[model samples]
Target: MIEDRYSTASTLYPYCRVSDQDAEPRRHPVVIVGAGPVGLALALDLGQRGTPTLVLDDHEGPGAGSKAICFAKRTLDIAHRLGAAKKMVEKGVVWNVGRVFYGGEQLFEFNLLPESGHRHPAFINLQQPYFEQYLIECIRVEQSKGTPIEIRGRNQVTALTDKGDFVALEVDTPEGTYKIEAEFVVACDGARSPTRDMMGLSFDGRVFEDNFLIADVRMEAELPTERWFWFHPTFAPNVQSTLLHKQPDDIWRIDFQLGWDIDRDKELDPSRICSRVDALLSSQTGDVPDYELHWTSIYTFQCRRMQEFRKGRIFFAGDSAHQVSPFGARGANSGVQDAENLAWKLDLVLKGLAPSALLDSYSSERTFGADENILNSSRATDFMTPKSKAATIFRDAALDLARDHAFARTIINSGRLSVPCVYDGHAHFVQDALTNGPEVTRPGAPCPDAPVEGGFLLDNLKGNFTVLAIGFDCSKLKLIDGVAVDVLCIHKPSEYLQERYLGGGKSAVYLIRPDQHVVGRWPEFSEDKIRAALLTALGKEPI
Candidate 1:
């Protein structure tokens, strides 16, 4: 049930008309705060699982502006699962090449598509608003399919209290204060997350000393083939540079570095913005082209990550959990992954299939991934924004080397730093007894997207636990009791994923959980081993 309430008491769910004087508890399975991508993604996943979710947000409509302009392959996969990927792919620009320029020449041009099989959309450049609108429509379709997802827009949560059994929320709607009670609450609010604040979690990390200006402007001058990056040292020392990205609606996103000497307040003026853009492009391109500025914002890059991603029954997703510079497009991709990581666990807990302890994996897995993203993005930031003289010298040396040598060029443009994150640790699946296998597509790694019998493998694994039996012998593994494991036999190396993953195998059998994490693997398939691994993953002892 979708409720776009300007100010109404009656709702699809159990609604009660009450003022601040006579409000009572209204319990739901889950209550989500903030209707951003992360929160709504969580809601969509929960609703698909028939878990009643109440999503509350202050804004009535989708967000404005083009904050995050990049999306990764993994995010595209998740979007495909939610049925929104097709829309995004059709509308957004597919960016497969990123060019790194130094001085006036192209220092290194990275073809990102060769490494990532053209199977996945490399990186997508799109305005955030349209991307979100597509998602909102998908959510509506999911609602029409009979999943009860209550969206209370223009209603901001004033306060939240964890009451052990359930969470109590005080929401300030247009009518008055309304109390909402739910078994769990997920906060996907932006950096200023009130839920995280209520948990008393401190976001502790480094704040970059420099700040930059982001502006969307109409351009007149012809630019290079919509390539993503431009690292020009032409304006070094003064720290003048620009990152130009193509946006929809004939606007270009321009990010420029303003040296510490410049005043941020002064840069807000249109003339100062024009001067900055002109300075960054004048020598290489030519005179300032005709342009109209649409929007401008001054922002300092922060690499701050939260102490924890979960607090009791409340969970934190998106910018609330961690924040990083937009160098490698880690911000939105990480948030989307956060939603994906959390959705399965929350579904299991809500459905009573797994104990609440299963929810603990969200913090372990997501925070680890967050730290890695921060490290990568920070490195990209450091390379992009060379602060000190020594740092600048190092960057120039690397770029010069790239220009001269093929090895150096490959080394510099590996872009392996931007690959999808692997869940190496804190997976809560690999146990001690089952840990004697070689490190070739082991547990905690993303199950290789293989093709089986004619279609993509994950397609068959839509709703069941899949047991990827890679090792040859499978006759003895037929009688696992009370546990379900779909068997897939991989005899030789797959032509599709030969170089990317460990494909040549006969002894490896992966017990894949429904959430798609490798729960267990054995050299030889055995009914007993499979049962124990599933029990352990679900936090249930074999009976």
Candidate 2:
């Protein structure tokens, strides 16, 4: 038996537990293993949906390292949904353009605004420490709202036992061994997840054959106006290279490649590392200031994803599920997507509105996404950090080609960083049926943004299910009780979405899910079809 003072926002809620003499017994609804951004995001999502979740972490406090400086538009979208995007955007640096340089010459520059259609809030460069703090604050506010979100810092889960109906877990805190039971569990414990190991799931993937020195240092001198990336030649022969990015706090994140075969003990010496950085910077500028090194560590790139995201009632999110190279900010962004995808499904399942099969789709949809991001990120890393002699020569040749061809230059230089991943392959949605409705419409596709009387069409469609009315009269459709769907009459959409969705001059209607993903669309308004798709998704029987 063990005892601890579990306090609420106003006061700590007392929690007591008893363990079996020889074996473990069943504690909380969902016990999350890691307290990183992924874990914290899941906690906030679950908490807001009125689900009980316990987040546990081995770390004493929040991590204060400069890792994952890039945030994709999709991640920013998730943050907005979580009610923290505005604050994050205010605190972070908004970067729409980035520069890639080779041998003191500009290879190519890519701008995101044109590609993404507008100031996408697409990608921002920010400190990971501050972002984590923002999430912690959001969790605290939710806790204060009477939706209990238990965050156990300095507590580690030692063992887990699955007993069919529920899961039993043993956690070791400063006091002693403790046990808790929950209906489900989510393991976001990161790359070295003990929860994954305990569940006996295979993490099948590859660890690259090169090490990189990661450093966060305050810039000592005037920096370039753009987000600069460099591939330079050093005093050492044709060996490893560097990757650098300027962060929010006047700090620069620098990564120097150490050859794969170098000795770990000799390679990780901090003084030697700093000397190399100074040498590289000195060649670009006459003098550089002495920098205060915030953190230094030797990390190798790894491209590995878990075979499955769930082991019984225990689900995995973040690094526990998939890990990609930090190239193009895919690692953290994908993990945030995992939390967003899982949160709504988990909420629906708990509320008994959907079948358990919907939960299975979470892994299928996200794992497919993980594979895509991992493949793209791995290719980017390979291009950036070439190991073999033949590959290096090929990479250099490609860069030379990029310098000559305008389109080729953009292709090689533009970091194809965050494409909004589609869940089309997942079998949950009624895809084929909706595709046959209109020429411009497609089933299971993202709702096309159109011009309406409101701010943006999407802005007004928030909160509940929305049914857009096209050329057909909406008054003809019969209303159903307790069903929430908005009818927006669009006689002239061309006046609004110029050159976008309505450019083809066709009237269309759409049914949007609460999460803002399109469920179905049609050229004509049909009361039966809209209600049917809604009932199917919401698990309500047809009237």
Candidate 3:
């Protein structure tokens, strides 16, 4: 087993007792519980805005295993903004093609990176430990740059009390227990969140009876760095489905679907796992490659989420707020987006620039996102593991038809891989009344990335409210106070940009939020209308 390969020492944060003469319960602007990807990303996002953030995690360092392998384009964009994407991309494996097979017959394949003009690719595969380690490094760099982000490892929040304006917390550390208070508390702790339990919140959704065996194997083999999925492959008997994803360090993530009534212990035995791996590899290549087990985990799929993400002064992000099956890679990516969504709103609220009501938009928008992920994940799970004979018949028929017809291939749901959620009907988004711009750049959608002068459009719109003017003058527009608007004038539009954005005409203006979601767009620039849209996007005005 590859146990020591990913071990790292934790960085300690000085703790002071509440009873100490000089040490009163230290009050922070924001206290984030759980220093995983979501919490760390939130800290980086807030820190970039010069917001003071404290992140506490019970673990001494990053967790072991390649828990989340696929990082999506939207997540890489967020990571790029946080100053960690370059490292992640450098240390990860990038793949865009996924091939599906049904009982040794290649059904069809799809490409995720069919378009250009975007900086990052469709997806990159890296171990979760590496992901977390890079985020921790980013946080430290931000702290050194005077961002005031403190990450305390091995510090667990044992108790929490919401006191209206602020949330009080009791933290347990190696030294002793201490108390602290924060204007806001973000729970990024995983599914079985202590913070969620402490708040008496419950998640509601379906937990699939099917169990999956996730095995991480390191081998010196010449397998393509693409996703390979199988339905009833001849390698393993009684196995309904299998998924294989290649990660960095020659580690391959293999998932096998084990039906409901499985002996958990027997299934996880090393010998049994090795035998299954040997059979799978032999079936694929007609020869078994030398390999060694790294990590193994057995998990049941769950598509669940709390009714509301925000509860009084505390907010839940990531898996704590919602969870879905790993099939779509929605769990981590959605969590990262959740952090991005909340960080900007929380920063504004902390700086007294926006009301607490602005935070409500986070709950509403992410709840919408979580619901969409749940629906897609549940459907994929249902297709992968049919509960009834009729469902199985339909699934097999679709697979059979996929091999012959292109139209039938669209119905095949190996997993409708996660895509960014567009907050289409969100209260904060102001729809464009003008029919000049492309529908792809409609309000509430993630600003369609396009090539601009010297770099991409999204690179220029980072970290602030952006007023993007394409073939138009927006110099006369005035924005609300405290809202920093970066006016990006695209003098010469690329073909991709023209097609995806300036469709009807070249003259268009887009008002984008800090999170890069389009708030409003217009054919002609209007200072009054742009200002009103900004206010609406920030929850300061009614749509």
Please write out the lDDT profile of model 3 over residues 371-484, one tens digit for every residue: 999999999999999989999999999999999899989988877767889989898988785586677888988887878889888888777888888886668443476777
TM-score of 2: 0.85
**Whole-model lDDT, model 3:** 0.86
**Stretches of model 3 off by over 4 angstroms after superposition:** 1-22, 476-479
Report the C-alpha displacement of residue 361, candidate 3, in angstroms: 0.8
- Backbone clash tally for model 2? 9
Q: Over the stretch 64-130, how does candidate 2's per-residue lDDT look in tens digits?
A: 5556778877676666667767778887877666777676677777665633332246678887666
> What TM-score quantifies how close candidate 1 is to the native fold?
0.86
- The C-alpha stretches of model 1 lying farther than 4 A from their native spots are 1-23, 114-118, 219-224, 233-237, 278-290, 410-417, 425-427, 431-440, 451-454, 469-494, 497-502, 506-508, 541-543
**TM-scores, all models, native as reference:** 0.86, 0.85, 0.96
RMSD of 2: 5.0
Clashes of 3: 0
Q: Show where candidate 2 strays beyond 4 Å.
A: 1-27, 114-120, 232-239, 387-390, 410-415, 432-442, 445-505, 535-543
Model 1, position 309, has a per-residue lDDT of 89
